[model samples]
Target: MVKATINNFESLALSGKTLGSISYATRKSVGRKSETDVAQVNLNESLETFSIQPQSGFDFSTSMGTKLKLVNARLVATEARSNGRTSVVQGVQGSLLPVSDPTVDEYDEAEYDMVFVTGKNRKPVARVRSKDAFDSQDLVLFGSDVLYKTDNRNQVIIEDDEAQKSGYRLNFVQSKIKDDEIGHLISIIISVDEYERLAPSLKPSQKYVPQGLRVAFVGNETTNWTLYADTVVPLTENNKQAVKVDSKPNSNTAVKADEKDMKK
Candidate 1:
């Protein structure tokens, strides 16, 4: 059995230096459209905020996890007008810096004074006052994160036929099960494609268990059991039809369906 821990697990992020889990996301559409249009033909914009908490004893200066240190960081709200215009409104102002950088002399002056704003809102999103030094009081910082349009297609390449066949194979086994432990050892097998498809619909913190799905084991309970689907076809109707036609007893249905049905 393989051992796994959260230490090496990588988390998914939309873009650019995520501090922590995304706490909030807001989308707005603002623009003018003609009478024939169903809705306003405006620019689609989104504003996301991430809660960044400094690790207790982790030194930001030496750690790779901590990307940027912002002192005198402020939260601002901006809105796009329907008349092709935008406005910025300042909200709150405070510092969120690295604990090691109590004095502002560690980082370059220009880097510390830089402020970035999202295209949707023209407000001062975050201020990078110092890279290394931060006040102890500024333990938590809210970063106004921005999301940009990205291609969502999977770009994996299966080098050979064998590799392609094994690309979607996934196995499950309990870790740290001792030889003498009198416990039921359960294992589940699934395809990577199916897992990816079902993962988005599941809760963020949900776990997949064979028992939860009411799966039963056959044969000797002492031995490990594995289950897998034959093959996963693409969810599109065209792909389903292709698979069905390929698996049919006879492959002579080249004629139109109406002609074949009439003959039958």
Candidate 2:
């Protein structure tokens, strides 16, 4: 997996580092924020301030699946650091001075300071790396402990197609599951295109799309599943053209007050 820290765009723009390099550096620095980390500790009351919302009614199961991979733009590197070096030079008296710098000859590793933001009002709970321009996704699980603290029903699924592209495998995890076999795994199958579409729907200030894409679990059972498109297409009557109405005559339609109106 490619690594990218917060302030990724600025780091890429000013310092000229690739996105992959930044991600690599950020993942190594620190543990991501937990749900409790963002919680507002109740000082006055012994009980923690808590609230709950009824989950919207929807079937949350899916079939085993695979899809095409997304493309990521590599930031252009402007200033490249030399790797740590080892060199020898003669002193004033022609005495040889051996110098050793372990990483001096290699590219200098990029550094980033982090910014922490608590999830509030439905925003994602996450730990972010910050910079002058924007905050990048360091780690994000969810908004509340109730979401993450529970036994996660998420599963990661990876698939391969032999006929289409040789040696290319598509990876996508089921978002919400019924009987999860694998332990909770972060779903990383979001395509770059999906990221672009979902980004705007989130708050204007929101920068990170942690999952890259959102997949709606569209069926009542795992076998009856279909991956909807990236955009949220509302279920409007126009799209329901094929939806069947009961052919059995209803009294309202059959027993029209005026026979002439029904005849037309």
Candidate 3:
């Protein structure tokens, strides 16, 4: 019953100072120009410029420096080189800010940002923070919105006892996120390790009814995060009436398939 937080790597806020002009994302790799059905918006934060691809069609009276928020955003990897598809964010919706700065509290309670890093940094990433990452979260997958194949590729590193998969991220969300309440679609880059550590006990959530997968994070602040897997919590007839359940629908947002020649 916990509300998902925004600190997860799969969710992000773009253009700290308001960034861009929205335009159609097109591809010329399929032997002809084609529309991606998503808009490409470039934004800036702290002087860092980034281009984000969000599902288009929502009208925003966007001008320069308009703070934007994108949900269900993640990077997708492709094994082939001819798909002409860039790593995209599965943004259900992108809205203007005042949606709240994703942090410890509502308003600007705390700040969050990301970048590609290569170093043994301080505090195991966010251990240096006053609030631990995902301290206020209890993720549960109600079901997949659309579970099908696509043109994305994944690479998992398997070692002696475990493995880490980081090709497509698992995106979770609140059953009914309010339009103005700053709902966040958390995309956890969970590895196999998270699945190993957490056990399912059927401790019901106050925010979400027990229906699909009771998810958990595998790591801590010290080691950052590892696996993101579902726990086994079976519902019974005696208590089934008390819980609002969701059908175990298949789910998968990113599925980059093998790339090939100029034909599908």
lDDT per residue for candidate 1 within 1-264, as digits (tens), equals 433211111111111111222221222223223111111111112234443322234232443333333333333232224455443322222233443555443334333322332322222233332112111111111111111122224222245532222112222222333423322122222334544564445332122322111011111222211122222222344432222211111112111111011011
Task: List candidate 3 stretches off by more than 4 Å.
Answer: 1-173, 177-187, 202-264
Report, for all candidates in order, the number of backbone clashes.
4, 15, 16
Q: What are the models' TM-scores?
A: 0.17, 0.14, 0.25
Give the whole-model CA lDDT for all candidates, comma-separated. Answer: 0.25, 0.19, 0.30
Q: What is the lDDT of residue 86 in candidate 1?
A: 42
Cα distance off (Å), candidate 1, residue 169: 6.1
- Tens-place lDDT digits, model 3, residues 1-264: 544433333333222222223332221211123333333444333443343434454444455455455433333211222366433222222332333646222223122222211121111111011112232234444322111222335333355655433222344454445423333443333223333333243233332222221122122222222222222233345544443222221234211211110011
Taking every candidate in turn, the Cα RMSD to the unseen true structure, in Å, is 23.9, 27.3, 14.9
Candidate 3, lDDT over the whole model: 0.30
The candidate that achieves the highest TM-score relative to the unseen native structure: 3
Positional deviation of 121 in candidate 1, in angstroms? 58
CA deviation > 4 Å runs, candidate 2: 1-122, 128-181, 184-186, 189-192, 195-264
Model 2: per-residue Cα lDDT over 169-221, one tens digit each? 11122233212423112222222344345444533212222211111111121
The 10-residue segment with the lowest total lDDT in model 3: 122-131
